[model samples]
Structure formats: C-alpha cells, structure tokens
Target: MTDWWLWLYVASMAGGTMLFLAWWARPCGVPAIEYQVAVAVPVWSGLWYAVLALGDGRVTDPGGQSVSWARYADWTVSASLLLVALALTATHALPRRHPWLPTTLVGLNVTMIAAGLLADLSAGSRSRYLYFALGTVALLGIFAVIWGPLRSVARRQPDGLHHAYVEAAALLTLLWIGYPLIWLAGPSGAGLLGPTTDTALFVLLSIASKIGWGAFDLARLRGLARRHELALAGRP
Candidate 1:
C-alpha cells in the first residue's frame, strides 16, 4: 500500500520478531514455551492490527460511523494480543506455580478476541463499551497481578524471561499512564484521536515497551548487580 502503511507493517513485524525471539529464548520447559506462545501469539497479532490501522490511517470510516474492517481488525488484534498478554501474566503469577497462569491467559485472551470480533457487528454505544471494557480489564490485570505480586519476582528472577516480564510491565504501565497526558496537551486532544496522534502514541508506547525489554535483557546480561555490589564484589 502507501509508504505509511508499509512503514507500520515493517515496524510491527519487527516488534513481532523481538517478541518471538524472546519467547523462544526464555529459560522454560516445552510446556511453558507452548503456553507462553499461546498468549504471545495473539498479543503480537494485535500489533498486526497496529500495522493495518496505521496503514489505513483512520480510526473510524469516511462516515465516521464506526470502526471500519481495517480499524476493527486493529482492535481485534489488540484485544487478542492484550488478552494473551494478560493470561500469560496471570499464569506466571500462580500462587501454586502450576503453569496454569499461561493457559488461563490464553483462554481469556481467546475469549476476548471472540468478544471483540463479535463486537465488530454491534451497533451504537455497545461497541464503544466493548473496547473500553477490554482495555479496563487489561489495565486492571496489569496493576493487580503484574505490578503487584509479579513485580518482586520479576525483578529478582534470573536474567531471562522473568526479568523481562517485570521490566516490560513497568515500561508499559508507565507509558500507558503517560500517553494520555501527552495527548491532552497535543494538537489531537480535542476529543479526536487522529492518526498523527495515534502514531505518536504508538511510537512512544513501542519505545517504552522495547526499553523495558532491553533493560531487562541488559540486566540479565550484566547479572543485574547493583553499584554497591559491583564495588564490593570488585570489577570483573
């Protein structure tokens, strides 16, 4: 399609690559990997929507009636992705450590995708609420399980999957929290989230997401030793 669409597709594919590579390299068993991918696939799938929506360059259609297929596809992908992401996060947080969190996340993610798809056919405010509610659920999950119990474990887990999860969660939360504030002051703040604004937000969110990934990976690489520990332990 257009350069912008191509750009979004390429960028989204890059994100997908990062996600898959990280998942593949995670220090977990086959079952865990499968479980992880179940959720991970959809999250990346949502990013697929990002590519499409960015390519189409409009949230609603020409009539401003409702989310177009292109736009709906974007939402579907996002809903699916977020669903899986949440599932994996919750599974990883299981009190019994049963590996159920990942499976649960996948289940929920699937349900969300289904709901989002069906919502595409709905009329009126119902559609809006579907999207809003999905977002709210994801936000809640992020706060409750990811930031709460998972954070401590994530920070301390050996320099791999665990660490990445923690860092990514923090980065995502921070960016999500900050993005709205930026939009409020930006030109697209007049109750209209334009393509430019969406692009800007997506760029920032992507940067934040990657920063989280990199920081954790770096921490793992460096053994995550603090300054004092490095000094006490002496230079390597």
Candidate 2:
C-alpha cells in the first residue's frame, strides 16, 4: 500500500474524473445526477487514498494493525451517493419515487457502513463480531429491497432501462460482497492477509466499483436517452 500502488489509483481516478469532465458531452435528456455521480465517486475515493498515501488518516490499533479509518469515511459518503444514483435508476421508470424506499435504502447503507467502521474500530473485542453481524443483517435488508421492491420497479421500465437497472444493481451488490470478505480475511478481522494486501485490494475494488461501475451506468443511461427510452423525472 505504500509505494506507487495507491498513488496510481489516485492518478487514474483523479485523472479520469478530470478527463470525464473535460471532453464530456453529456447526452441530452439524461438526469444531471448521472453526471454528478460519474465524477463524485472517483474523486472522493481518490482524495481519501491520497490522504492515506500522504501518511495521514491512519492509526495503529491495539492489535498493531494500521487502520485507515478514512476508508470508512470515504465509503460512507461515496456509497451513499452510489446508492442514490442506483436508486434513481431503479425508480426511473416509476411515475413518482416513493420517499420511503430511497430513504430506507440510504439508512440501511449508512448503518451497514457505520457498522463496518465500528467493527474495525472495536477490533480485539467481541463486540466487533456483533457489529459485523448487524452489518450483515443490514446487507440482507438491502438485498431484499433491491431485488424485491426495486426489481418490481425495474419491470415497469422500458427494456433498455430495465436491463441497465439490472446490470447496475446486480454488479453493485456483488462487488459489495467482496469488501466484507476481505475485511474478514485481512488484518482487521482474522489476519489471514496483511495490511498492504488489504489496502491494495480495497484500492482495486474502489476503482472498479466507483470508476468502472459509473462508466457503465452512465453509458447505458446515455444510450437510453439517445433512444428516448430513459424516463424523465416528473412525467407520467
């Protein structure tokens, strides 16, 4: 995690963010939030990685593990934004987004992230496992909502939009599973892996989940907009 590993991630993410903005011709009729998220996720994660690269935002826990709690901070904000972006896409076909589902999704996301953070912070204690369990429960709830209720919304979408929603949602959920598995394997939980390896995995995952994922979603949305298949915000 020390050397060019994280710095390269920062360069890719930050550079990509700038390049995406520079020659960016956002397709017409796409929601502005699409562009906003396309930029925000990478920049935010890169900033925190920059912080880690600069040797800040980290503390050695009692177990002698260097904990970059800033990664948790990064996840909290960026994952929330990602959830909103996905939620918008999920409900894009609906005439009006019910306030409850989006709000619940966000709440569950925050809870899940917060629980992971707490689990990491409470390392060397039994409660860390409890926190992990709670986070797992929250994760299950998220799955139920997205696959059950949100999938229902997807059914109402045009074919293109439905496929986009499925792609984004399924990838997101699958990618998310890697984090906890790594956490359990890395220095934080079972110590099967070292900190450097842990950090490297997180960096790669962030790149894929944020930068790569955003590109796919936005590209799909852009194509849908071009085809006049994307549902606008207010119109029934």
Candidate 3:
C-alpha cells in the first residue's frame, strides 16, 4: 500500500515485460521448447509479483504474521521451470543418461518449498522454526541436484556453454541462498525487517534469478547453435 511497494510492483511488471519481449523478438536458434520455458519463467514470475503487489499485499497468519501466497505460487512455477531448463541444458550438453532425474528433482523441490511456506503460515511459533528447518533441508537438496548432476552435465558442454551454465547456476544459488535469511528477518520469522525491505529484496532476487539467468541461457544456446552451424560449414 506504500509508494515503495507500488514502485516495486511496477518495476517487476516492467522487467517481466522486457524479458518476454526480448524472448519474443529474438530469432529462434536454440531448442524451441527449452528456450521458451527459460524465457517464460521470469516473465511469469514478474507477473506474479505484480499481482501480489496490486492485491492484498501480504496475507497474514492468525498470529498477525505476514506471508505472501503469491510468492509461493511464483516460486512453485518459476523454480520448476528453472530446474527444467537446467535439465534440458544438461540433456543437450552431455551424453544422455537417466532422463528422469531432473523432473523428479523438480517435483521434490517444489513440494518441499511449498510445505515450508505452508508451515511458515501457521499461527504458532513452532511452525515458524519448522518452516525454517524444512526450507533449509529443501535448499540443501536443491543444491545437491545443481552441484552434482547438473554440474557434471555442464562440465561436458563446450566451453562457452559450460561457462554460461556454471555462471547461471552460481548466480541462482547465491540469490536463492538469501531466501531463508530474508524469511528470518521478515514478519514470518523474527520480524527484524520491514515489509518494504522484504519487497525490495524479493524484487531484486526475482529479476536476477529469472531475467538475468534467462539472458545467460539464451546467449549460451545461441552460441551453441552458431558453433554447430560453423562446424557444418567447415569453418572455425
């Protein structure tokens, strides 16, 4: 309801629109399905935040602790898309192995994060700690998937794509690491931080994780395509 909240929402909407447009306007070079999913993730995330901002702001638990259902929803969709993108990238970059790993991990990650959010929304203080502990475990699992299988696949990629994948994954990991900290400082946890601070952090994290990562992915894919074309043409 404050000016900063309004501004943050507007920024989110704008960032989403720009990313979508960039995706739409660009010529397709990468695998269409994967590229589109990567591009769409951030756009959807931006819209979700925008709606959350324009709507009830933050819904509070029975104890008057604030929670953002919209954020949870956004994470559910966007985070899954992120994993899917990683999966697709891994499949493209490396020798095929088990195809089910990425999808399975995506499902688990979403469920875990969703449960944590639900626990955070409970009216009792015990649920708050439960949410924190649950979320920490979920994050560890997510990191394992990224660092283990995902990293192994990326290492097999060509140098450009390998570097891009590593950079994108690192960026995502860094940005996501802040979520529990933000939760701790937010109303759902210790109430050490204000709504404005929460909104600002979420907005920045959303843009970076979604749009920034999408850009890296698209660029990497395009670079891969160019290399393939050059190889076919018998050029460098």
Which number leads on TM-score? 2
TM-score: model 2 vs. ground truth: 0.90
User: Cα deviation in Å at residue 130, candidate 3?
Assistant: 1.4
| Error at 125, model 3, angstroms | 2.1
Better of 1 and 2 by TM-score: 2
- Per-model CA lDDT versus the true structure: 0.46, 0.80, 0.73
- Tens-digit lDDT track of model 2 for 57-119: 887766666778888888888887787788788777678866677788889989999998888
- Give stretches of model 1 more than 4 Å off: 1-97, 106-122, 149-166, 176-190, 210-235
Of candidates 3 and 2, the better by TM-score: 2
Tens-digit lDDT track of model 3 for 128-153:
68766877887888889888877787
What lDDT does candidate 1 reach at residue 62? 32
How displaced is residue 29 in candidate 1, in Å? Answer: 15
CA RMSD of all predictions:
7.1, 3.9, 2.7
Question: Roughly what TM-score does model 3 have, to 2 decimal places?
Answer: 0.85
